[model samples]
Target: MKVAVHPDRRPSHEAEVIAFSYHRLALDLARHLGRDVNNWYCYAVWASKAVSENLDLSPGSCFLGDVAARLNVPVWLRRPFRRVFLALLGPSYPLALALANRAIFLEMGSLAAELWDADDDYLIRVDETGDFVRRPEFLSALLAPAEEEFLDAVVRLFTKARNATGPERAEFVLGANIALVAYEQQRAQRLLELVLNRPPRWLLQGSWRWLWCALRRRPFHRLAIYTAPHAELAWPARKAERWWVRFYTSRLMVMRTPVGRIQLGRPLPPPKGAAPETVWAPIQDLEVRELVDRFLPSDFDRATAGVGNWLSFDDRMRFIVAYFRMYANVPELFDPPFTSDKLDELEAEMDEGHVPEPYQEWLQKENARRAAAGRGVRGLIARQRYRSPFRSDPDAAALAGFDLTGCVHRRTLRPEAGPEALLCCGIDGELCGDAGGRCGRQA
Candidate 1:
């Protein structure tokens, strides 16, 4: 049999479809049991204040708007007047609209009241707290002892409807599933299985499992692991882990290497064997070249021409990290041509900061230049102890094993050295300090 196609289902549409299905099922059950059931109510309890504020009054607002639009006024005048009136009234406009369209508003309000009323007989409250009480005291008080049989019949009928083959079956099952959400979960599962002959595939899907775990108050880590293998390595999972680590472990250390960055439990002890005297390592020229090549030609020229000296340490660090991360993740996004001239220009810019200039004067000049070029002026300037000389001709073979140590060293690299220098440290202990020569203090 050919089934009618549905409109593309947005979140709201899915909700509405489920609600309509549940209402129909409730009506069918009432008719089957020879009892009068006026309305079915579905209440979604929100733990978040923000979510409650966004959703609770949405339907009422829509109802009010529909009522206002049907007010016999011409469409052109009506829309303009409505906007002006709403603008003037601010938060109180909904109340004013309800009052103006009392008849229609009241009718809509009555329907809403039936669905939202705590005293309604066929109420289903989904607890955000995850306590799916199958039969709350208030609900128990409303039903006679014998009426429990009617509820059983309702569940069985819903199960049958859920199992039937049709386009509507999925929607029917969804609605039935929600209605039975508060049921003793095991009993609901068995009844559904008896009718459908198998567990619903949706119940085992990732999104559904996530929702189920969330409702059951599972910890985020547990939820993450439950949903995906090696989820701890996933970005959001790592972020969640980091948040807890930051809260509990005050001394976590982050180390950057040639291969990848690593988070350590604590700072490493000093090298046991003979280590290199120079603590800081020189940044690979290839990395610097890559950064220059990644930049737009105009940006490359501007940055190379001492414009980088104008950028604050933080801005420089941010720009560098952003560039590298983008390059690593989506290299296709960048398509800039590399030129020897631009590299030479960058090398020229690096000459100005060989000897540290007066911090305030350098900042003033940078800010003035930025403002002259229609860019925002820098507010704060950080003092720099040393700056690296940029190499115009970077050796590709020499940089084959280049490792960007950490952000501390990257912040000190000369602008002409390119953005990648943000990851490398000086080898002469100029940046990190000498062994037993205040290296720990410098870090």
Candidate 2:
């Protein structure tokens, strides 16, 4: 018999319906809310699900989630696994596991009571029953366990979040956004305030905070960017935004210039709504208290600890898997990349022919170019040639286009793919979101 079921009840993987709680759902939301390594690996797996592209998906992806659980990350992460030299990075394992734990929710599913809709008091028409029933009663039956039991868990989760205070509430805070609940208007506004750090009316040095808001696609809202990762971000989840992500195109001009400094399309700020406050989303894979005790940075006041042009990770092979520090909020996992030795040490290595051939050649020409330019002569390379409004680093789409207009779309991270608006179209039809998992499966 056919019955209306929410998309949340029918996960792409059947097991997901059973394992999913606010935890896994929050991780899913995080991917949609911001850009991370999961986007890259998930795209490859989804594009070739038939071909069985070698990549990770279930149980969580790298960095922001449970990448530590499976040390053998997908090839994309492996490609970036390097011995970056920086003192700021200490140990990656503790923090990697911390992020992984943050993605697990064994006890938070009870908040399902918030699923009740008092506004319209929906009625469900089950084909088998041939009768009308309260929407809450019908939908609650879709849960894996007793409706009341799940409601208890959900209530506890939401109450904890509503009652919590300070930065310690970040994990539950992220979970609140994704947890199945029907929040009152007042409660919703409060939740938004808890997650978002609204910059005061007063401005800052050089208007960096203002630019953060303007570029994030939310010109009206005056908010800041997350100083760290995963939370305090106001990413676009509108229908138009999703469509653009799936169909947005750009110009290809990689070959126009042989070599020179080229603009990378203004270097978008975290690719979404991010703020300056650093909040650590809790993880459950490891000892929650232990993870925070040992790995949490003692100082969050590093001068250069602010957002970087690109996120950096500390990669190392340890224990049963390779530990990585990719969470911008937790620099403790990064590698220590400073040395007090004399300047001649690095110069001596370069002089000893240790530099790669391409860089060595570039160096010789660069010095000659600088000298020639000083003398008012032509340099080895010409001016920078740029194309595309977002990025021009030769992505998968741009390479395939091989045309003047190298069109591209977001391979993953679509809004419908996350916790989003419900279609709620027909009374007799299934209570579906537009997704139906078709677009998600395609991505």
Candidate 3:
């Protein structure tokens, strides 16, 4: 006779069930602590899993509980792994992992009371059964025999992962993990920009088969493809290159590059519900502590020492990868049907002092127009075409569209900010009888 398992009992990956399990234990803590449910780390855990496309472990919230119960794994088994992971990943994994860890721990505690002894330490066994699940007589006893060694292995694995692929791929993976766990909007936005601006180098070159493999089945890989490579360059360098390209395009008018200035959109403050003050997540700090302890092989506190504070390995690699991606994507922005042969022909023609037909026509037209206006042709050609936006350049093309004269005073700061300030500030000032304090501008 075949064993028949209930449909729900067969291990479901349904979002609702996973969410329920994650929120059940996680939200309970918030309630007991008189905290908001949304502020719990589990929310990030669930969100991270949802965003990941290549996770081998079930995205189910109860999966952690199952991993603990079936494998006799200790709740703290992940502690060492977390540090190594974060060290390799940099500051991005903590927020996601913390929430994930919380859910896992809650489920572990619920699954087996013996998992954690009265000493607030998890038990472990070397023989897989975890039969040696006993509290230490002394409070100072280390959790397990291989605890130290295992943490070392984690760091090694991260190193291996970095070596297997370039730093670009590793950063992408780590960034994706961090975004899942990030609590603050600023942090999330920063990660998102990094992910969007720079993709791993693996996605850009190598055999088509290899590129295909890297780009598929992973959320980070997918994002890498979307952002392309050249856009990943540092803002300043990329902006310079784009300005040159735009100037060339305007003169030649042969190629239409999508390469434009990095126009920063209007500043959007975090929403009221997304305030970081209320959502004081502590995963990043914990990961930092773990990494300093595990990798540095010294007694210095990572939190106090600030090991990953200024330009960690991952941080530096991230900018490099992003800028590389930006450079890599540059050639693709030109009109398609462009080939190496065509580029060669163009270069040869330039060397032979032969301007392209279109460019010649444009030059002639510009010369005639200048002559009619009584301006010398030599003067126009001698003018410097490129100008940096960072510096004060009067000749720089308008950053935005034409300015509206009628809306001059209102747009002193920003057009969008003006209306909102007028309405909200006006009402608040009137209600409190505080005219000077109301609105951004004086009433």
Instruction: Point to the candidate with the largest TM-score.
Output: 3
Question: 349-380, model 2: which lDDT tens digit per residue?
Answer: 22232211111111223323444554223332
lDDT ranking, high to low: 3, 1, 2
Error of 2 at 38 (Å): 18
Candidate 2 lDDT trough over 10 residues, lowest sum: 314-323
Off by over 4 Å in 3: 1-18, 36-39, 49-119, 123-203, 208-269, 273-443
Q: List candidate 1 segments past 4 Å from native.
A: 1-7, 34-179, 182-226, 229-443
Kindly give the stretch of ten consecutive residues in candidate 3 with the minimal lDDT sum. Answer: 1-10
Candidates' TM-scores? Answer: 0.17, 0.18, 0.22
- For residues 182-290, write the lDDT of model 1, one tens digit per residue: 1222122221111121111222333456467557855322112221322325565544443433432222122232223322233222222313232112223343223
Over 394-427, each residue of candidate 3 has an lDDT whose tens digit, in order, gives 1111211111111111101111221123222222
Per-model tally of clashing residue pairs: 5, 25, 15
lDDT for each of the candidates? 0.26, 0.22, 0.27
Candidate topping lDDT:
3
